[model samples]
Target: MASREFLKILSSARLGDVSAQQKLADAYLTGAYKTPIQPANALIWLEKSYFSITNQALEGASSGSTQISELIAQTANIPLAETFGSPAFGFGWNSFWGLAQSSIESDSRSAAQWQLVNLLINPINQDIQKQLSEWIKKNATSLEKVSDLDLGALQKLAKQFLNELSESNSSFATNAKELLIKLQPKNEALSSLWKVWQEDQNEEALTQAAELGLTAAKLILGLRLAQLDGNTETKSNASLKKAAYWLELAAKDGDRDAWYALGEIYRRPQFSGYNAAESDRCFDRAADLGHAQAQLRKGASLWRKREKTEEKIRGLQASYWVWQAHQQGIAEAKELLNKILDSCPDPKKNDWYELAQFAEQALNHHAEHKLDEDWLLLSHRIIIANQFNFSKAELLLCEVGQLQHEHCVAVDIRWELPKILPRLIQIESIQQRRALLAAGKVFAAADLEIEGNLRQRRYRFDQVTSWLVTTFFKDQTESAIN
Candidate 1:
């Protein structure tokens, strides 16, 4: 749902309010809540904006006429090619031609309009270019004998030629539409600039292409500008600002590299706009987009939160991100992941409480007390421990069967012992895999109290062990329980 403010602005725009229309156009370009970025819709509103202004200016001299004229002049000041480009008006060649044909009567900015049309429609048609240029030149000149060119006749011929093209729209319009659809965003202006830059590494062409709303050009231009060093602090700051501007534009277009670059800029202490929060957000966006460096950074940052008691749960999260980065071929991530794994207690080195003596006695005790869920759970745990070689801590604290991956089991005892990080143990044999599957079924139906705090679980284990040793293992029971 849109807010009341947006609704009011929308109402005003629909009622032909130029300011409101321009605002809506910018909103569509940049995107806002309930309005995703739509370049085509932005262009349509911008076109309607100028058209409304033009109409107002033509109506008569009024208090708003001066303001309207100023806006028209400002729009007119932009180079015709750029004005029609996707970055400016988001108009395709067909759209521009349609505008030119419809606006012939007003003739407010006919020369520029026709010039853009000529440039966009048929750059290969030299005859049309030469004719339009000569015709425009003659019309702009007011001399009685302007270099032997008849201004009125040339104007008539130009209008007649434009009318003829407009009449032949079926052939040209359909072709232009098809081509535009094929060339996404349909801005030939930027495509030409790409060639211009590639020819001589022209920065000017790159800048133009960036201005024409090419995401790649914006990213390249932003990166090039970001690398620049100025003679003074002021100049350096200015350069950073320019780089940020272009990078932000690209970031808004969902460029991951641009987002990462913006993150670096915001994180820089030397940059005046240094903002740690904003930098974190930018890096988060980049990481979400699968930027390897950002993922590594995010993982390392998460790992740093382990000191906080509440952040222990994030240890697995940190490992997950680091693992993601490692899979993406980041060398540092592999080292960090190794370090995290090394911090975990190896189950093989852990104390063994469910040994053969204890296990056989526990099985006999469980058989005698078949209705006891605790004994049943303990039996399942013993079976798991003997088969998979899990330690007493893992057998007691681990979420059996549920934590099984395809080829490995995730033994997480963090719920009882937050210090003992989770580790994945591989299922090396068919026997081990079957044991795990069987354990999963038994545990799934077991009592929830089977998984309790360290103290409660340790007490339960000791109580069961004491009872089993005394009743089933009388010979060993003579030796006091350890």
Candidate 2:
């Protein structure tokens, strides 16, 4: 059973309320809201909340302006109050809660960016301070946005909070080891690390960056280390070990490129972590996440000589993934999908396939002649299939849904429905026959009105009905043949 409160908050979160999302994450984290504590579910909510808040902050940065008067004037046409309270704009709660247009001034909204920033800085739930600190500790990519804070005081405060919440692998601790680095990135390693690496082509700067859990630096360092070849066994062994360590850190964070790198690395039997099983697993993970080339490789991996049953199953799986990659515009995937589909058994034996063939033929004939007898065949077949309890007959009807309204009630009554209604009345149930006859009479009246012949045909309903019965159903076998 699920908690109603948790379900309610989850709905609000899904509706894109940033605060609701954070609260749901908190609920999953603490388990105090009668929801079970699940770290994976909590991380999902936390990710949603963080991205929502960050996007809102970026929007604020782009849209906020110092010219507050123009922004306010843009909304002057709106009659609604800024806030709602009793005796609006009066003393007590109303004084602070509600304000009319005349009460507002440009000076009051001068620091719009600061106001948006303050929302994240001091959220409704104060516990987010600790939650955010721990979150950034693990997902270090968030450092880019945090580092974008322009105010020196806010930057200093953020560093202080992260520093207090730091752990052994913490990015804050690594960057804060020196005051200059924490305050300014370029000068933070001005003297030795950056100069040693940039000017000298040494790997020291990369090592420093990787240690701070920066994903790009880790990838570069891993690649460089993987390329190392030493004259002695001691250094050669050390190089691969360092490469594996750095790459593994990035891969664990669900970096697709890092996982692909590991797959390439393990494909070489000489590498430290080289294992056929691990290499295949890495490729499978990347492919499952929509990597185009990885999808090709994953499909190819399963496409091999095997037992017939096993091969058939793997072939279907490979075709599915390859088809998805093709839809994503991977040319290689498209070529592979065509080959796989061609090699598979024919699909025309499916029951729906037969129905579709009939539909296609009927549609082509109808396309050539607006009110073809073939349209009668198409409609009767669908109506007959539905009577026989064909599960997909309704779906096929929907596929040709446009034809239903293509003819006006006038056309449906005269040359159209009269050609088929006799057989329908004979085969359909009593209730359905009555409904069809009643609808047919109404349509005949409408058809006469549409042709400006209503007064001429007003008393001809019984004559038309009697004619249909005598002409079509007068001979049962003739009606069936038509």
Candidate 3:
């Protein structure tokens, strides 16, 4: 059931309040803004809200818990967390219940089972876990849903939970390994070899399998050799040489994972002669071949190497690979992309930089020509200017207006309260209320002086406002369309 507080926020958000919309989006993302975990809704609000601070550098770090701290740091001009309330607090639910319910309704037993296992690792009460254990026994026979949870978080949680069980002497300990294999399955033959090798503490079967051309098996064996070689590179160690031989064989057989593994081996100078160039090539090959992890590695690698050379678009190139990985549903990639995009400038989109500058000026209450109902009809000019062609700015602006006020929203009929009034009157604090209104003014204060037919330079009003609206979608006339 939705909480009363969530309901109130939603009501305000529906009425077109900018702060409400942003808060609502934040809530969905982190439950911090005092909202439940509903990423779909969060994305909607994020796409809809136009921020006064659009600089990527201004975004709070992706750490869910530190959002408030980060927000406080970003808005230093305002006495925050005090007379003016900081964004409402709470970490919304990012739990197993949603997936568990989906598992119950779906038909994919594999997926359901995975969800149940994931749920098992959450910080649930022991009683709940016992009940869940029974529930899994009931539903384990069948699975029918594949959750869209962030892969990185899921993997981390899985590893942590499984590691606990592996180290414990509890009743759950016996089946922990089985559960991991079930939660994230691999090639059947390779898995079987690993199962015995890991469980029995015997490597004979796994080694045989690697020799028999099982690529996954070979990768595992190579990893074992690398671990055994420890911090010293032994050119004479037959084990290390043998590991390399098998890794090369796997790579030759078109195993992308193998190439990445080889890169990892070469990356560690502690082991032996770590050739940075060779390691880079191996990683690059793996990235080109579409290994998502490898793509992230290369992205970070290139960015780190930027200081010593005049590398053109080093960050951009890195971001492109990271973005590709993010699209493939890698959560770590999303986190990295967020940081990269926030700080990296888009040379192709200088307009974005201009917009950020305008946002900064507006927030400082320094923007000019922000009022409406003018003779020049600046709002209309912004739409017709075509200077921001296909910039996708309009959609965001429309959302910004609605976000400021629950009512009086739209491109033509925006809730244009005075430079002193908030879009949402529900704001109670005088300073807080004023802060909201001021932010709105900042958004409306876009007056771009561009070269014109009548004059060398002309002020374009509502450039920021119209930019809040984006027509990136087909056949629609609402801010929500884009």
Candidate 4:
């Protein structure tokens, strides 16, 4: 019969049925349950039943089998496939005893067997070493067998068990460390594991390990202590000093994160009085160590400092660093780069085009860091530069103050004020008049008559004469002097 039917036998055994319990144990040991059934799970279930049977036998009561099915299932760790039908049931009392013999070693076997069982079952128990020592003394033969089993798997199992125990019991961690040291004397893994245990926020573990020169433990313990001394007004300097000591050691060990933390400390207004120069150096060092976020921060510091400097080259240098950071994919670096490039002038037309193309490629490459504001401003500049009247007006405004209304004629107003003025005047089509006004040359009476007609509301004959005397008088005076 398949082993599943053995569950029923186990149930019957639990009700003080000795025959059923023996039959179930026989089914598991002889592989009569099914083909390809695992012996490990079979042994576990049989062993539990054997213990119950032994307990009953000792008590002189009906050896009712213990319902250890739940414990068996919990330890199985693997899945079982369904059996199609029950196999032929063979009745044999001798077969049950033989199956039981293979799994349950005699008290005479070897010491290794006892140690193996103890290690597997009670690996995390606090008294494991003592219990193992006792088992070795009582069952030397069992221990011999245990030494023959796989050592690697046993060590892994022990570590796993100890890890679980360490979660709730600090003493277990100490014991586990001792065992690991005995097993792998020169290995660093044990030390590293202990370090993790110490850093765990458990107060007991942290204090104990921090005293043992565990750097990470020391750092975390210091931070926790600082947090407890909350009233910074009373203990501010002391707290910073403590934090700084651990942080300096960690930073000296090439911990880039430690450098960044130190930078934050020095940069804090309350702690370091905002020492920008010192903070910048720290951030720069961290950035050099391939700290991506630190690169961004360093670039920002330079950009801010550049804003307060009078040197134009300083502004460009700031933009250079920001671009360097942007190349490293910092989002804020692109914003800073845009602001710098917006106000800076290009020395050549080709350079200006290249700058525009660079902005376009930046938008293409890093869509998240697109220089939208700078692009829009440059685009507007290009559009205004293309218009003749607006360009002339801009140049003229740079040279002269705001144009007076009456000085519209004879003043050589090369300044194209069309962009500044409302659309009421159409200066684009009057190319000749615009040229004449720009050259500081007087136009013929007929041309003036046309202008008077075109802008009659603002330029009447009397007003036109007054504009000539006031606005063009400078030119007249210059001509007389020449």
Candidate 5:
């Protein structure tokens, strides 16, 4: 059943009220007032509203012109996937144009005229097509002059606009040049090159695309170059260098596979420029970007072989990365994560009450100087400690971001207190997760200088804890007695 408001709008729309028609269209578009979101119905009412508005404009009064135009733009911009649904559906633009042609008066085609002006002239819609429209509007002459403007490969809206423009303007040629000098990487030539490479196994086309600065092409080219010299024992330094150059280019563009491939290239012992540290860094980058193999590799590297206590510490730190890989369906990661968790099973939950209270007082006291005074970090550590049950040593030494995991938090304080073992703490509640998220925010914003070395952190913790206990707690106790 329609709401009273919707019924009223629908009744007014039936009576040829333009504003009511637009409101009815909006109600259908967004399912407002319990109306079903039917794109086909929405377009129907929008067409009715357009015809009514154009009729009114012809009669020398236009009230809802801007509102209707903006609504049409919004509807036009909706993804075609969402627009095409059951009870009578077509492309949004097609339906819009089809109904628009109903007006007998050529000048009364204001809504259709507005759409073309918006698409070709003002270009208000902020999407890929709009961007292409802006480029085409400015480069109309240039587009006509260009030799290979892959019109077919252009986005649907852009292709339609170009075709219409060419039909309307006698000077505008169908054959045109490249229009993607500004759009980089996602051009017609790159798409064509990719298609040719995939179908014909043309390395030359692949090379051309790579030279055109496509990150995917660069990564593929690098991998192919490296594959040709599969055995590192016989691989020439020149071949490895060539592959590394392209991989490095792609890695700089934040391609995960490129980073992982670069890591592998660096790990090859026979490579002239082999660097274990650089290899680890590349793997770390790839792991950070959610690459499964890199995550597993990084996790395995973090897990140190040692005494049971040290193993727990290392395991906690390694578990997060391993678990990440496991979530991505890596069998080896699942096994490794399970083994680590088995060794460093969740300890009995113990929170620091006095420390938590002291942190709160210190936080309020140094509210203005949280970042510069390091009170914010102390507060974050206290929150982490209370929720994850971190030891004082762990709280002082652990890096906040590294320990954060989806299911649990990792705790490793061996950097400052080698005797104190690392531990994995399970996050068992929504409250704990929220606390971790909030604390993580503080650590993310804190400066490296303020976070300090383990020694400085321990010293600050000692100083602050001692001062808060002596002064703040004594004052509170005295007040309570009074």
Candidate 6:
């Protein structure tokens, strides 16, 4: 059931009507109906009209179809590719220009068009390193011209070229300084552009920026490489070496961010060979440089070491470092301070609670980038405590088949028992256990040899438990949960 308005638009579009075609394109581009329409479909309709108008101009060359060509030129700036490329498939360039022209008649596509033009021109035609150096020298006085051009367009082209440059060990490093110097004045804008460029995986820009001694770029590239190291099954010494090299350079330059990054690398046991001593040193250095996060890390490391050694002097030292970090506005430090103070052997528990409340206020004062590891530790502690008290563990198991804490899922059963039997035994409620047993029976209908104790009863549960444990609980064994 097409609406009258839709039918009218479709009828006009079918009669080779440019206006009707554009209107239909607008509908698809805007997703005027509910649930936002597909951008590819929008582009198809828009491109059809665009091509038709262009072909008409080309065919009617003897009669100077200026209007048709003008229309085609106007439509060329639509970001059809950008829209179609998005996961949601929303309209981009097509809607921006069409809507703007229909309402305000403003030409928003000029910048994008200019950028496309520049890309086609390929200002630096030779090797990027050589070309960039020459361009910088030639245009040093005319640097403002680069800024004056469509920045958005130039940024897109830069990203594309930078990606190409990153693929090979080209002259990017040699000319990186010159290019950065040319762009240094526009640091804020360039940084924003860099964020967008990085999303496109423009490694060349990242490499160039790193070579130009951009600490932020160096840190970002290092993090990206570290992320890749995790995704790939094998270790990448090259990635770590590259990250370490840039971080060391940045640290030497007295960049606090670099120091923090170095601390992070050293802190990660798997990545930095579990060099806690070296990690402590890096954190100390970063903390001295007024890095709050490094201070927090240093405090946490000290606290962890104190826990391992059970030395009262080390405990006091950990508390002092944590308090110092807390004063510097580190949220994790405040949290650690609260936990330490709560466990202190003070006669007045109320006073410790009051101090913890104050620490909570301080904790809320700081911003956190990721989930704190303390939460997992605390959850594991709670779970272990519950397991020690069998009644509480049974209560928890009665409510849920598995107790899901931040650290791991606790299935109520002894560790030595075969995997499946414990899960079946954990369901304390008779009805739920019956349902689960019945469900299990569907698979075990043929083999009905229900056997001996919990260990023997786990024969069927073993297969299911093996899969579950391997899939979800494999990494969880690292946590010291009794």
Order of all candidates by lDDT, from best down to worst? 5, 1, 3, 6, 2, 4
Query: Among these predicted structures, which one has the highest lDDT?
Result: 5
TM-score of model 3 vs. true structure: 0.33
Stretches off by above 4 angstroms in model 3 are 1-201, 228-238, 270-273, 290-293, 307-314, 324-339, 343-482
TM-score of each: 0.43, 0.34, 0.33, 0.28, 0.39, 0.28
lDDT of 4 at 355: 31
Q: Give the clashing residue pairs of candidate 2, or none.
A: none
Tell me the spans in candidate 5 whose CA falls farther than 4 Å from its real position: 1-183, 228-238, 305-314, 342-407, 410-422, 428-482
lDDT of 2 by residue, 141-205 (tens): 42332333333444355344434322224322322222222233444554456556657766667
Worst lDDT run of 10 residues, candidate 1, spans 173-182
Per-model clash counts, in order, read 0, 0, 31, 20, 4, 2
Error of 4 at 432 (Å): 45
- Top of the candidates by TM-score: 1
The alpha-carbon RMSD values of the candidates against the true structure, listed in the order shown, are 23.9, 22.0, 18.8, 33.8, 17.5, 24.1
Each prediction's whole-model lDDT (CA): 0.62, 0.45, 0.47, 0.42, 0.65, 0.47
For candidate 2, the lDDT comes to: 0.45
Worst lDDT run of 10 residues, candidate 4, spans: 82-91
Worst ten in a row by lDDT for model 6: 420-429
lDDT of 5 by residue, 181-270 (tens): 122447788899989988997889989989988877898889878874254553533478889999998776657788999999998987
User: Alpha-carbon error at 407 in model 4, in Å?
Assistant: 52
lDDT at residue 13 of model 4 (Cα atoms): 69
Q: 79, model 5: CA deviation in Å? A: 20
TM-score of 5: 0.39
